[model samples]
Target: MPAPVQLYVYDLSNGLAKQLSLQLTGKQIDGIWHTSVVVFGKEIFYGQGISITSPGQSHHGRPLQAIDMGETALDEETFNEYLEEMRQVYTADKYHLLDNNCNSFTNDCMGFLTGGSIPSWIKDLPADFLSTPFGAALRPTIDNMFRGPAQGGSSAPSSAQPLASSLLQSVAQNATGVQGSTSSYLPTPAATPSPPLAASSSIAGPIQICSNTQHFNNLLSTHKAVIAFFTSHTCPPCRIIEPVFERLASEKASAGVAFAKIDLGSAYGGGQIASVYGVRVTPTFLFFMGGKKTHELKGADAGELKAQVDLLTYQAFPPHPHASLPLRATRSISLEPILFTQSVNFEAVRSRLFSFIDLSALSDERKKSIENSITSTIIPYLKNKADEREGKGKGVNTSISSGAVCEAWRIASKDLIDNLQVKDIFPLADLLRLTLLDNPVAQWCSTTAAASGTSPPHAILERVASALRNEQQIPKPVLLTTLRMAANMFTQTVLARTILVTRSNGHHTSLTTLAISCLLHDDSLVRTAAASLVFNMAAFYQAPRMEALRSGRRGEAEEEGDGEWEVELLSAVLEAIKMEESNEDVLHRLVASLAFLLHLSPFYETQLKPMLEVLEARSTLLAKLEGVEGGFTVSKKEARALLEEVGTKLCG
Candidate 1:
């Protein structure tokens, strides 16, 4: 059977409450009175905070009106839990004279118990009382008189609280027409205060008490995983789970999984945090990883709580088998040249490329000179060099060389960079794009060895990279084009090695970070380009390493940074797949990259399972794309098959 709910309202006076409002604020008002919700014959009330009192004794006089709020579907346990949550929010310290007084509490109670709020006229009374010029001017004095220390007591109820109480009691006694007895309804103070909740012992591991939202968020960010226990001092279930919570904290301390208990009864703003998470019960547990809430459990079931804590701890601190693996297995793989099969339209590209260049940014004669230098001089020079190299019976070198074409590239790059403005950057990028379309120059730049002791061909490409990095206000087209050029340079084995294998100042400027940064770019085209670049790098270089790690020679040097670079790359790919705007091509490439990275990497499988689970849950999308054709260069059906195959391998 549904629980019965009733709304009981009391009149402040026959009509004196209205007269007082008119005198103080020069505005007529309805009678002010106290209100409460009676649930299942028990008067469940929230004043400064939540309380329970006898039903018939609540109103000093007969209520002005008793409205049936209808029955509630909530069971006794659910109702009590909701009340406990309300107690946290309506704590004594949080009450205000005009903003969050008893009326507000009553409104909340009504909404929860009956799925309806009290009338707006009753709810907005306090605000109406304070809105007048005279009322506003007298507020400070009235506030001080009522809010100062209570006579013979250290604390005082705000003016609104006492005013409501005094008027209700006085009028109840004098008004002959009222129905009930005029007895005081104020709760008798307890003779002995309840003992403070025992603090969880440090021997069982320290349980941090988060006092505010910022503190809780900071803890989440600092720890790899966190278990937040929301407890209340007055709740029996919360107390019952305390010891078990502490025990698990102690057991998992060494694993770097943080344990925290929030006293919703005592901690300031604790209720606000609970509200943010939609927690409406004591002994609620929240599990967070990487600043996201991954799991939640409610109730005081110790066995279930312990099991969840164990699972979270295990995931937070997984065993590292890579520690025992060979250095050869973990080391980066060798780089290789990426050959393009698509036919190029050189004249069409050159024409469109020059059209976007900002001639106004350059002197007219200088612009003409620059155009002649790249097209008339640089292009012809590169073509001639490529022909000469081919005539000499030399195939492409394994390393980039600082030759005539390389020198000419450097000069042309410098000219573009010196005069380049935001508008001109796209044209310059397009120029680089056109240069790569010339197969001979592309092959020469990609494979030739650096002229002894000089900068490699890849180094010339850095001029463009540097310009993009340094210029903060670059247009999206320019940035996309620049990234494309860098990606194009990486197709060369030597350049790929330079970017991926070689460290600059002990830090790898990873293609993973670069590609991930652009994944969120406002322009879809930019995101597509970034996704394509990531796929190319991962497919060519990183994929083979995973395969070799599964079946190749072993070596030493077991100690290294936890594969953060690999994790970052994998995370980026997964994130791109999850994005709402990720097109079929982007998803295809991203999944392919993920498949390559997961191959034979047992450690990654454990770390990546959560994200993979998210993808698996979206089975509809996977099924839809299973036979749909279109990818970086393959059909969606092929990409889906590859993903499933890798997923099976990882599972095994």
Candidate 2:
């Protein structure tokens, strides 16, 4: 029978939002909604993590309304198992006020149970508040308020405790409950009631709690292999083998393998589960593969259980194709970005930049302003950075601070970059590129640009990209400097690399677009820098793919646009590979970039494989390896090997 699910909505503002919302936000929001899912005889809500009680018994007290949210086909046991899986996600520390609060959890549950969503008005209150001017001003304060005392120096909102006087009365009123225990009718949460079980984020270790047949069947269907331990509480042998089962689960439970425990005599549908599998004895272990029972053991034998589990795991996740090839040198290629570390005459670069400003067709006031900024702020900071790099002043206090450098660049980006003629932008860009090599400056610029604001944090990079795209014939120096700047962005921090590679939005200004444009440039120097840029981007994309292949699960942080970027990058590199001829260094970079983009790709069969076949990627790579006049020299051997591996292994 399908169970009815209701949405219990509460007003956390306790009636204050009705009076103040109109004056504060210029919108008439009735209440600050806190919601919970009441389903299968329990009221589940997320506050300091997930909590559960009988319907109408939570501290939030009788809901503003119990909305009929339709019914769920899932049995109680199946839903309980689903809630167990959700524990790792809806953790205490992950809770937030405006973003990921009680309403968010209930909406997720509502969708899962009924294939429907909560009312949009209830969920859109935060958006409404931020949409107004006064409310927008108070966003930082509101955000801090919910981050808790540990993080934001403010205590979390106090959840109202259930009144002591109502405890006996509430229990008496709800005597007939799910478990038919007097304690089940009480307002207090059940024992295993905490939502966020402090397990490692992805790998939940101990043997999973299995209380129903549907969820167990769901587990068997999803995993490559499953081990079900059927045991009885009265059996001494069952107790002896329980620790071994837990150890195996802790060691082997992953996306591919699942470990579950079903007590055959416990109160929660255990006898039904036992009867379904025909498990007539205590300590009976059943192994399933491809959703069929493969092996069954009846004893407290730890050795047999461990052996069977190991064999199934080994069969499920076979070794990767790359493991068979002798491509250790190819796979071990350094991922560090190729930097423009050649020391330059800083004084000469500074002098020429100022000279360009002096010679430019601008007002004297504007010229003086640029000169003062360069002299007073930019130059000193660059010198201090240079000194830090060369280890010149080890202990002495450098007068130019990081804050001053940031302020100087802030002015340069907002005031100077846009106003200057395209010809003069290069010198300023070149100077700024050198400063970006410093880790602090790079991290600040990368993270700030991701913030929501009117002013872009990386305005100078934006200006450089704009000039590169708009100009009909760019000077070689400007082009080379721009490519080098793009390549150098991969250094210092992962945030910078992620921002550069995964940030394309159909804009010519994207760093990915910039790299593709300069890839097959007429100048080999420009091509080399462009290749480096592509290599950096490819390496960033490939790192997680490699880890995913190893772990059999994708990370939570991976973006949806990754597949689109991969296809785009692979297409551009293949075109560049066919056109690349004379310079072995350029060819090496191009070949290496292709290898990183293709190796261990999760979408190889669906996306990359067909694309590779269409592009004749194999023949193209073979031409690079064999068609070389004398073949690659011994020093360039890794490049040849990498090309061969990509053609034969990855392209297939």
* Per-model lDDT: 0.52, 0.63
lDDT of 2 by residue, 1-652 (tens): 9999999988766665664344233345687788889998889887655778888887667889999989999899877776765565566544545545677667667766876677877866655554433333343334343332221112111110111113212322221122233212223444124633453322223244454565466557556688899988699999898888876765565445668777776644456678888999999999988898888999999999889887776676554455456656457877666776544566787787777777666678877766776778877777767776787763233676777777767765555655666556667767767777776666555435433211222454565567666754667776677677767766643334334432332222357666888888989999998998888877765554453444332111132235666788899999998888767888888888888777656565568778998899999988876665544432477777887877887776
**Backbone clashes per model, in order?**
8, 0
Q: What root-mean-square deviation over C-alphas does model 2 reach? A: 12.6
Ten-residue stretch with the least lDDT total in model 2: 156-165
* Candidate that scores best on lDDT: 2
- Give a tens-digit lDDT track for model 1, residues 102-140: 565676666566656666667656445544323332333
**Model 1 per-residue lDDT at 276:** 84
Count backbone clashes in candidate 2: 0
RMSD (Cα, Å) for all candidates, in order, is 25.3, 12.6
